[model samples]
Target: MSDHELRKAAHDLDVTVWVGKGGIDPVVDEASDQLKERDLIKVKFLRAARAGTSVEALTEELAERTNATVIETRGNTGVLHR
Candidate 1:
């Protein structure tokens, strides 16, 4: 789907994965698995997860590990698509 369409779709998606103090390591597997079952998934980065990183950076890292693309990021939430 187009970026715009993906963003629109993501607007209504509830966050299916969350990153907290454990950071991306703990959620990488889950994110990859979710991508296998769905075209897109929403992830929320809790404050603890963003202490030293920007959401964009964290999103890119997670997407790389999961073989997904970043649809968009708003505040602390990001949408990923495979």
Candidate 2:
């Protein structure tokens, strides 16, 4: 799908993964596993996980680790696609 289509598709997706104080480390495996089962997944970065980092940065790092692309990020939520 195109970026616009991905964004539109992500609009209705419920957050399936959450990053908290533990940050991305704890969720990398889960995100990768989910990507294996689905084309896209939504992730929410809690306030604790945002400390000293922007959602874009966090999303990039998580995507890199999971071998996924960042479909989009709104507020603290991000959508990822493999």
lDDT of each: 0.96, 0.95
Evaluated at residue 65, the lDDT of candidate 1 is 95
Model 2 residue runs over 4 Å out of place are: none
TM-score, candidate number 1:
0.97
Candidate 1's displacement at residue 20, Å, is: 0.4
Query: Could you report the Cα RMSD, in angstroms, for every candidate shown?
Result: 0.6, 0.5
Q: How accurate locally is residue 33 in candidate 2, as Cα lDDT from 0 to 100?
A: 96
Q: Which residue ranges in model 1 land beyond 4 Å of their true spot?
A: none
lDDT of 2 by residue, 1-82 (tens): 8999989988988899999999999999999999999999999999999999999999999999999999898999999999
> Per-residue alpha-carbon lDDT of model 1 for 33-56, expressed as tens digits?
999999999999999999989999
